[model samples]
Target chain A: MATLDINRVRKSYGSMEVLKEVNISIEDGEFLVLLGPSGCGKSTLLNIIAGLEDITGGDVLIGNRVVNDLPPKDRDIAMVFQSYALYPTMTVRQNIEFGMKIRGISAEERAKATKAAAEMLQMTGLLDRKPSQLSGGQRQRVAMGRAIVRHPELFLFDEPLSNLDAKLRVDMRTEIKRLHQRLGATIVYVTHDQIEAMTLATKVAVMKDGIVQHFGTPQEVYDRPANTYVARFVGSPAMNILRGRLVASDGPVTVAFETSDGEALVSGVPLSPESAARFRDREVLVGIRPEHFTMDTAGAVPLTVDMVEPTGPDTLVVFSAGGADVVARLDPLAISVGTKARFGVKAEKIVLFDPETETRLD
Target chain B: MATKSLARQRAMGQTFIYGVLALLALYYLTPLWVMITTSLKPLDEIYGGSFIGLPQTVTFEAWSKAWSGACIGTECTGLKPYFINSILMVVPAVLLSTGLGALNGYVLTKWRFRGANLVFGMMLFGCFLPYQAVILPMAQVLGKLGLSGTIPGLILVHTLYGICFTSLFFRNYFITIPDELTKAAQIDGAGFFRIFFSIMLPAALPIIVVSCIWQFTQVWNDFLFGVSFTSGSDSPITVALNNIVNVTTGRKQYNVDMASAMIAAIPTLLVYVTAGRYFVRGLTAGAVKG
Candidate 1:
């Protein structure tokens, strides 16, 4: 059974509506992530689920019961904040034990939970030290231990690793993934980092301008985004959005767009047959992930490389097509600035969106 | 040759700066010097000699008289009891006002409701009004409650006035604390008071120290409310100190009056000398981002 169901949730502050009617459901033990840029109402959704913020409309259900009126304590959930929010004066053991102590759990039970959580996060040695004495990563582990000791049915993470430096963020991301797998607890995490969304989420919901643009598996969102926004938002260097005309719609649809050198052609998966026929000869956007481009001597599209960015494993070639900069990931040895490179996007890799609405055509 | 002149020039500048600082210190300390010497002089020498001159013959008569035998209208029982009264009044006033202001500030910053800023502004408006402006109405209310001539009534007046400043202090300090702390506490299942005692209040130690010191100085030094609301044995040290200075019935005992003034000034001066570092910090702690 799904552990959480958000039905038609709408939030507004006065007349400024920050979230439109949004819906999502997370099955038991699934890691559901709300991903977006700032002001996309992702945190608002997280707060509403935690009962910290009231929703303007719609129902929030946890374990088949509406929790719209329940206080955060009554919801049987724990949250780790972006700031970690560890109590400044308390030691690590006391921090982890605080919630249980407040709930009137026996001292023996609290001690057992605290000990178990400390060992789980590998923070046993730092149990007696205050939060200010620990390093950033240790503080983050203490925050997680504070949440885990409660054994809540669900865990909420609000961009918990955002405060760390780069290398530490990556390490904590892996640690969080392992923790989830070990506990098999249902979790709903909110973050603006696409890489974190991609690496950790079993389900990713991409949000923008007060609405969820797409909700699907990470591969589904990355491979077949529902709109130009979702496609651009979920990938590093983002998906290349090329304005093109749908030249053919029969067996395999093809789009033709202008490159700096000349016109380029790309064969793509057809939209639904009924919709494909109507879009034939009409303007549409072709969304192609950077990794989908391949360098080939006989490739149909020729690109005049404006810039080359070498990123260790691969190099990204920046070129202009249809009045937009497009980035293509290529072998580090394959490309350089000011070179003429011919590239091909595989037929199955292109997704189509209506140019005016930015929505998927079918 | 160049290095020698440069060294000479640096020495000249340092001397010039220190010379100006010493002159300013002397200018500020001249009155304190006058008071100390006057308090040590015999009454006959004070009447016969230069005001700024050191006493030709020293005497301890005035310090003893000021502490034990000074007359304030009819009472010659001295300031000992009134000093205790000020301690009683100031302690409770400082504690109650600071406690209430912290709660007010926590609500104003974290558990905000509609028009919370407006409400805080209204409370802060109280800090700007001179206590004299509200005396008539406040005294009337105190009289109706039959608390007009009591230390508790005076404590009430000081607390009502002191809350405004303390509230502003806590609000500014607490706002720098991320709202995430409160949200995390709520998720931990702590209700209002629990979160305050365990989480927010512990982290507020610096601001709390600042608020208590600020409230103590204001209430301890207050005179207008003390004079207007209480009299006689029920009066605070400030009022009693005033009567001793301004209402001497016999010869104008300059040495005795100076001794009494010094006694009254000692507590506040001692407070500053001991915790002055914290006072400057408390004033400026939340102005910068944490």
Candidate 2:
């Protein structure tokens, strides 16, 4: 029954409305990642759920109880902050047991819980050391351990791994995923890193300017984004958004766009005939994931590669297409700079967005 | 030959620097030297013009007399009682002011609300307020409260004045502590005072030492408030020291005066010598890169 529902939450500071009527919910044990750029109100929404910040309007429900007026202490939750927020003076053991101590739990119980949490995080040797003595990754584990001991129904993480180096971030990311799987705890994690959102979240809420742009499972958001913003924001190298026109053919409707070389057409777009009729002969936006382009010699479109970026396993080919600098992830040695290449767009992978609204079509 | 000349040049530079430092040390130590030497000499030796030199006859008589026998304006009691009075006043005043200032800093930085800036601005303005400006109104209030010419009245005045600077010190230091710490504590089920005692106060040890040293020295050495507020037997050491130096009997007792002055100055000196390192450390601790 553990769940979080943010119902019609509206937040504003003075006359500046930071979050409009936004709503998102996650089932029990689902890892919900509120993903957005800085100042996009993702952190604000997380703070609201944690009861750290007062919501300007609407309700926050945790485990079927409205916690709008509950203090953070009474909200039955634990949070891991980006800075770790470990008590600088307390040892790791004391930091983990502090909440239990505050609630007047027995000393024996506190010791047992601290020991279990420390062992789970593999930091039992660091229990007696102060926060100042630990390195960044160790501090991050201590923070997670502190949250783990509480055994709260909900866990809130506010970009907990942003402080670590790239190598340590991946290691800790896997550690967090493992912890989530073992504990089966409902978690609401916030990060601007799309990779973290894609990898860690069971459900991802892509946000912009305080509004939820997309809310779905990781695969769902990647496969069928709700809008252009979500499509571009949720993927690396971002899904290429091309401005093109739709044509009504004897069979199915096709989107015709221009590559660097010449005109191209992609059919089999997932649109009904009735909806396709309205967009016929009208300019629309075509959303294509960078990986969906195939290198075929006798393909429909010809692309002139302007630059090639080889990142070990895969090569990123950048070409001017659909009035934008479009990037296509391809196999290494497949393309090089200053070369005109032919490619095929997987027609079934094409998504059409309304040019004016920037929303995905049917 | 080149290395030899370079070594010689470095030696010469070291000698020059040490020579200036030695001269400056002697210059500053001259008055203290005279005071100590004068306090050790007998009255007859001071009168016989062995003032700046070693005493012709060394004696503990003046030291004992200054400690237990000197009179301050008809009061036969020495600086002993007054020193006790200063301790009594300075201890409580320093504690109250420092504790209140830490609380002020905690609230201003962490538990912010509307007009918190204005309140902090007003407290900061209190720091620049001259002691003389508040003397009249303070005296009137003390008189109405029936606390005029009392040690508690002086403590009250010093604590109120000390809060301004101590608050400024603590607020600036506590501002460097991230707000996330306080929020984390709140989620951990700790209440306001619990968070303050467990998290804020433990982390504030350096700043607390800084405030204690500053307030102790200021309140202990304060003469204007000490003199204007208290009278006669209830006066602090500064006032008693002034009375002993100014009594001016048939022939001035320079030895007793100097001894009394040194006795009054030792506590502040001891305070500085003991905790001086933390003062510099606390001032720069907050400047660490975030």
Candidate 3:
């Protein structure tokens, strides 16, 4: 059975709509991430699933039961909030045992669960200390322990790592992934970090302006983006988009555009005949991932490099092409600033979108 | 060497500032010192000379009279019943008002509802109006309910007036706590009351101490409401102190009046001495952004 299902959930505050027709289903043990920028309602969607937020127009089902009217306590779900939210007055042990205590569990059972959870999170020695006395990362682990002791049907994380420092955030990211693997628990996580979505999510739902742009496996969303927005939003250093026109309409289609220095052609997957017929000699947006560009003797476009930024592993080169600014990631040693270069676009990696609609044209 | 002289100049400037602060502290404490000296002086010495000088001979007569023998109208009630009544009224008033106010603050900050801001704005405006303007109406309502002369009635009035300020204090303090804390509690299966009592309330200790001390002093030293709502021997110490000081027919016993006023202020003064650090910390902590 699917562990959790959110069907056509919509949320609005008065006339201001925050989430619209959002839908997702998590298989029994999958880690699904709702990935979006701030104010895109990813947290709102997670709250809806946790029953902390009331859905305005649809139902949420957990383990085959619709939970639209249920309160958070009855939802059988545990959540870890961005702030850690450890009970400030309680000791770490009490914080972990609070849920079981409220549920009227036996003292022995509560002790067992608290001990096990503390041991699992490596917080046993700190169990008697108040949250104020613990470090930020330690408090975060207690928060996780608090949720783990419940062993709820589903786990919800609402940007739980956003508050940590950079190094701690990376460490917690790996810790959470390990926890997921160990528990095999159903989790619905929300984050604005695309890197986190890429690294941790089994499936990623990219949201924009309160609508899900695309929902698929991370590789699918990255490799086969459904629209121009998804293509630009899912990757770091962003995909380079160039304005072009379809020059030929045949079994094998081609697009042509003019840079400041020269004109170039890139051939790729043919559009549908109808779409190709309509776009003949019409404007289209061609998107190419930065990593797909390569320096070759027989290159498709000639350009002057404006700048080259070399990090340890890769070089990011900024250059002008097709009357647009484009960035390409190349081998760190191969590129230099203020150099004239010719780079080829991998034709199979090129994506085309309708200029007006911005939807993929493949 | 020039830098060392500049540092020396800064140190001298700081010393000058501390000297001025010490003088200001003495100036503020002058009246209390004078009252204590006068309270211990014999009436003859008090009437004979220097108002700010040490007493020629210390005596406990004034304290004794202020505690047990002083007359309030026809009764020789001194300040005992009034002091007890003030304690009774202020204790429950502070406890209830601060407790309920914290709850109100927790709800408004965490579980915001439609028109919540409007409700808060109205309550804030209510705090600014002079308390006298509402006393007559409050008195009439209480009189109709047969609570005009009761301690509970005074408590209810004090708590009602205190809620606006106390809730404002706590709500503003709670807004500084990250909403993520409450959200985390909610996800841990904590209901509204649970999250409030377990998570928010515990984090709110400093503010609660502050609100309690503030409300206690306000209600304890209150004269207007105590005089208006309460009558007979059920009056608070402030009302008794006022009557003793302001009644014109009796010989003006300034010594006794000062002692009684000081006595009436002891509770709040003791609270300040004990938890003054928490008071400043709580107020500033609430004002901090996140």
Candidate 4:
């Protein structure tokens, strides 16, 4: 296992910069996921780590060695691609043994590695089949086998599960998690799918416009996102950002805002003494996750429900709050269309951000 | 009664499709039938019988004569030498052209330099040029190089023409392969040559078969360059066949002429028969990838 340090790495083609001065450092044996939308430079960063692509202006260190100029092979890394990228002409055994053969390992060692990988993936029966003859999931497993047989210091996965069906993607996601645990290898995975990052990453870096927005544990990212982009990008149905003002009183901080019927107030919302002193009478954005809202008779404010989407275990209540579309995850049995419901959130669950900068405050 | 009528209508549709196909097949085979029967018949009977009529008394005289002692301008040597010459020219020409083309295609598609597409466009323009237009300039160049009227000269002409076609074939074929495969191979310690030989070459069998078949047919059937560039024993089989047929001798030996034509066509027929499956795959490989 090895640690990966990306120090102010920048990439550009001509005058267009694809990666800004970005920095990320992961310890040994951590599954670091770079998650973002398309054109956000996540895959580019991953390629720079693997040494498949050259960086414009920064240093990348693998296990304390600056691999700024090393070729991908000399960098001692293996990548599983989004397309599986298996050699179509080779049988699974040959595919797994291809790298080892290039390294001139013994035939006996290659056979042993192939057999162990096949058994580990539960594809021992498929050792003789070509990649085209296998299913998508099986082909992905062979790609993994090819990577694992090298026993490289780092395993890079660039959206390896993107081509799979939804059910197989979930299964392979769990298998990859298990593989990470069993091997304890350092991994840097790039994906546009936020759920994959949330489920697989020990440390998640949310990137946007070539910069790292936030880098922290998954729970910390979800609960206390560093900015509004992370809050909206990392969740299903997304977090609601409501434009309102926090009124400071000596008793307790209260959020005063417009309701569907008329102006209403929600008092007793807690705040850090630092934030309370700073934003006493200014407008701020409050971000509330869908799951944080609950059904209450006398709650923060009353809003008219526009739609209720039933998703089996729970239902999504869609309503308007402070001129933004706010969604609440209410009990399935309690939600109905065209209903007047009062929703509430705990003071600690409410995250405050500056309306101008959109960064979380206190 | 309605169900029976529907079944009858389906049966009628099937019969209609099969009938048209059979008619087309028969129409295609008429020339082949005439050629085969005419080649097997003796000269006396060939004159005695109708051109469309099958031979009543078959003889192997024409075949043996075409193989051994048929005269092309009083040489009287059969097509065996010319056939050998064609093979020798085509084998090296096809191998060299295809090797260069595969390397060119690999570089153009995978390891591209600056303005690669512009370079490819210029190379592809060679495939569209009329060989008739280049025959004069080619003759001048060949004369200057001191290779005029030689088999090696013909081989050089054929290899230069074949490169554009074969390069186009391999380029379109290699374009269908994902770049990720090359990247993954790079990570696996495979250098440029290693990755090409181990990964790219093995996956390229279908396209290679296609390129070889195309090159064989193109080089083997080229009469314009063969007749324009070489004469006498230096000529390819197509030129030899042309000479044997149009000799304007005492009496036109139609049987010897037909037999030599059949022999000239046999190699291409055999090539298609052997690698026909891959030929179809190569033609349509890039248009629809699976």
On TM-score, the leading prediction is: 2
TM-score of chain B of each: 0.94, 0.96, 0.92, 0.95
lDDT (Cα, tens digit) per residue for candidate 2, span B98-175: 999999999999999999999999999998899899999999999998999999998888889999998898899999
For B1-290, candidate 1 gives per-residue lDDT tens digits of 99999999999999999999999999999989988999888888888866799988889888888888888889897778888999999999999999988999999999999999999999989989987899999999999989999988988898889889989988988898899989988988999999888887887877888888888888888888989999889988889889998997667889988888888888888877888888787667677545
Give the share of true interchain contacts found in each model: 0.90, 0.86, 0.76, 0.98
Number of clashes in every candidate structure?
0, 0, 0, 0
Q: Tens digits of per-residue lDDT for model 2 on A35-120?
A: 99999999999999999999899999999899999999999999999999999999988899999999999999999999999889
- Candidate 2: pairs in clash: none
What is the lDDT, from 0 to 100, of the residue B107 in candidate 1?
A: 94
Docking quality of model 4: it rates as: high
Please tell me which predicted candidate would have the highest DockQ against the true structure: 2
List DockQ for all candidates.
0.86, 0.90, 0.65, 0.82
> What digit string (tens of lDDT, one per residue) describes model 3 on residues A1-362?
14888889899988999999988877898999999999999998888887778889988999989999988888888889888877778898888888888888999999999899888888889999998899889988988998998898898898989989999999999999999999999998999999999999999999998899999999988987889999999999888888988887685578887765687787765577888888888999888899998877588877888888887799888888776789888887665667776888787777889888898886
What DockQ score does model 3 reach against the true complex?
A: 0.65
Q: Which residue runs does candidate 1 get wrong by more than 4 Å?
A: A334-336, B48-59
On lDDT, the leading prediction is 2
The reply for model 4, stretches above 4 Å from the true place, is A249-252, A267-278, A331-333, B1-24
lDDT of 1 by residue, A244-322 (tens): 8888758678888899989888776667887689888998888888998887878878989998889989998899998
Q: TM-score of model 1, chain A? A: 0.97
What is the C-alpha lDDT profile of model 4 across B168-268, one tens digit per residue? Answer: 98888898999898999999899999888888888888889998999999999999999999988999999999888988568788888889989999999
